[model samples]
Target: MSSVVVVVVGGGASGLTAALELKKSASAYYTSPITVLVMEASSRLGGRILPCDVPVEYESIGGGVLYERVQLGAEYVHGGEHLLDVFLSQKNIKRIPACVAAQGDGGPSGFQESQATVAYYCGKRKTFIRFQPDNTSSTEPWLANLNAHLRSLADDSNATSSAATTGKSVADGLPRDSFSREMADAGYGNTLAAGSCTLLDEGETRIMEVAWDKQASGDATPEGGMSRVIEELAADVCDAIRLNHYVHTIARDAETNRIRVGYVASYAHPDDANSAVPEEHANEILVDAVIYTGSLPSLAHVDVSPPLPKVVIEAARGSSHSPVAFASEAIKAAVIVRGCPYGEDSDTDLHAVICSNSLWPEISFRRAKVGDNLWVCGGFVSGTCAEDLKSACISRAGAARWRNETCVVLLEQLDSMFGDGGKGWRASAGQLIGDHDAEVVPPSNRVVGAAAYAWGSDPHARGGYTFPRLPGASHVRASLNAALWPDVRAPPFFLAGEACGDDDGAPMTVHAAMESGRRAARRAIASIAGRGTLQSRM
Candidate 1:
């Protein structure tokens, strides 16, 4: 038996998974030995799953410098036995259940506590809604609508319709007018009305709701950084992965008829000034099959020889029905904080605070795995552009400005909800337990350092896992899996990524990426076997 050479483009979750899956299923599917290769454009293997390490010195608290790893990209396991979750559990990584808290007034005292409560501010009065486990009736208006939308999507009929229509907006099926009326009837505030109105597209919200449901079932990150998972997945195929090999173009060989992948020798070293200059056409490799796992935004920039099919191109760019998910810019910023805002004894709440009137949508407080009396505040930004968000993440000047502004806004919001000294409190047991004696760490003292990440800014990963911008996004996603060439003998190129919504059960998620990769790899292997090309080496 001869060897079948396979190349996987992009070293993200999908690409890595595809390579591994190819290796696993090779024996059964291929008549000969299979060689799997993964080409990564960036210097690192993990694409969007980045762990930004911050050195925090706890010398004052009797400890050394602890390198706290914060998630800048994909954080939180969306629960269930998805690929990531299964891997973590098998590796015996601890999974912590996330607790959600809302802000409410502490009686007359201005200090409000963030514990086991879901608070919403309406007009001048602060309303508190205690979180009850297994209770669904009291779900927030936004959450209720989201749940209903997910239900509709889960139905086979609706899902099939969505998969066929590639140019319809989500608003067409799930009208915003109906959603707004329901929220108004439920008595939600103006701020929430505006925020939830544009939270996500109707179908996009359905996907998010599915994730949130998993979180409620205890979505959590392992004790170590998420990059650890990537490391584990790449363990067996470490030798096959070529880091900093940015692919510029892909085409089929004219004579050999094999696939030829063209890439530049990218330098990973930060000090290396030559990293910016692409050694034009410096490197090329020919493979029997290529599984492209790069994101949609990334593929749009790369030139494909002989040109890709119109449907594939439309999926790469954006269609009227499937507006690019990248359009909804996502920005996450994290800052090291001293003194637990929820108190020392507060149970681990994945999401510590939900503020109705604040610049940040929400902030999660995590107890540092390495340091004591250490916590971090982080959240996503809404109504921001990709360029502005990207600038805040990359440029030094932009980062400094972003940090100061975020810290200031966070302090004001926290004080408004928890500064009990300014307001009176009802003296009743379990009514309002004011921890006034506890030292209130000022923003200056509490905020040791901060960092930000803008997914839209990344050149290799322009869009952080895609979402449905419009109703027909699902159809666009499905098109990615369709054959680029009209003949079905065997496609030279196969697509895999979160954007490939072939698996309707999981789209725009790690599970979807892995699933798509497996699907593409299997198809590629089967194609080679069917064509009887495995007998000869390319």
Candidate 2:
């Protein structure tokens, strides 16, 4: 009996997990050795899970090299269950409950002094309304609108097929997913409203609302960062990963009944700079099965000879081509700043500041694990689609310039909220940012450094995450996950990623992506085992 050669493409969370799962199951599930290969397009793994170091001074905590590990993606453990939370628990990792502070739009102060409060900024009147969740009467109107929206969404889900055939857009649906409209009607601006609706699907939005109601929060990163999970997962499959291998094509080899994968060497090894290997020259590999964990956009661009089933192609195409429909684009900016902005007697324990403005819907500030003087503050900006958001991060001036602009905006907002009434802190912040025409704006001592990234701009990623808009998306995902016709003599091929799940309860999440990979790996194994059993019988 020959070993089954399985190739996992895209060494992100899903691909790595699939490879690890397949390796761990070698003895239990197969009679022969199973060879697993993980091909990553980028020089590094972890996909959208990016972590960077922010310098912090640790004078209070014994004065060591204290730097805060800030996460640029997948920050929270949503619901605190599933494989991610379990892994964290097993590793004895700690999760910090996020506390939120919000300032109403056009409020006298850009930020409020109170913590754990929800402030709605009225774009029309330019006033802020602070809502107390405990006050049933005050919150009844918003709750009513939310309940109504959910009912409408449920109705739309039931009638989606008929509506789609009738040429109805998502806007025509019963619930209609107008988060901004709903929020604006409730006196809050489109900033928070759009932010919520754009990031999550209808079902996910509902779940989040429930979680918010409970106030029983999910956890943020452990002390260092969320990269530990990636490091651990990659460690298990490190030997199998082929970094900087950009897969451009996947084809079925009719003669050998194997899958032919074509990829180009995307980068140069530091030691082999003198080597004359052309990066453009395509390399080929033959595998018994393939688990594609690449992004939807990357999958769309791949040349599939003897095209995949129409359903699979349609699903991938729908995800990639429809930039405005299914997915959301976002830019995250992290700024390293000095001084204590909010706390008791200038010692603020504030973790996050939710804004009603469009520039930064939410700004989070967290103290460094080791450094008492350093803090990392980040703001998330949601755009209408891929192009809109990508431009904000990847500008003609370059990412660094965009990052500086974003940080400047953040500092300005902070000046409004925390400034000493246009004198004390504001004067210091202006000096730090420097004048607009200064050619090179030096960061004042108060502002250490700033960095920004838009995941949609990444060559491999092409988008932040999946957010299925219409009801038909589930069917498409199911088709993508389904194996090709068993009667066909083609090679075994499977699709797995954040966008490959059919479950509405768990979609567009790290755990869901991992689950999808595990499922795909199992299917690939079963296909191989079934073929082996049939060959033996023959």
Per-residue lDDT tens digits for candidate 1, residues 1-538, read 5567898998877888888888877755445788888989778887768888876656655655567788877665544666667767777777654444211111101112223233332212333233333443465454444334444544434443243433433334444545323322122111112233334344443443333333344445556766777777898678779888777778878788788888777544243221343547868888788888887766776778778877667656745444444443556667666656555666544453444434454556676665556677666553333234344433532543444344444444555555534321111101011122334443234545456665555667664456444446556666777656545467778888877744334345566677788888888887777677764333
Error of 2 at 324 (Å): 9.7
Model 2 reaches what TM-score against the true structure? 0.75
Q: What does each candidate score in C-alpha RMSD?
A: 8.5, 6.8
Q: What is the lDDT of residue 419 in candidate 1?
A: 50
The 10 consecutive residues of candidate 2 with the worst lDDT sum are 102-111
Over the stretch 1-538, how does candidate 2's per-residue lDDT look in tens digits?
A: 6666889998888898899888877766555878899988788888867887755534455544456677877665444556777767877777655444211111111123333334443333343334444542454454334335543543443333223333322122224433323332222222222333334344433332332322224534554566777888888888899999877777888798788888776653332212333445358988888899987656767777777776556555654444213333556777766656553244444443444433565566766554436566777654352234346534633654554466566666666565444333323434333324333423334655556666655666765565444445556566667876444654488888877753533345677788788889888887777666213222
Q: Score each candidate by Cα lDDT.
A: 0.56, 0.57
For residue 267, give model 2's deviation from the true position in Å.
Answer: 2.8
- lDDT for model 1 comes to 0.56
Model 1 quality (TM-score) = 0.75
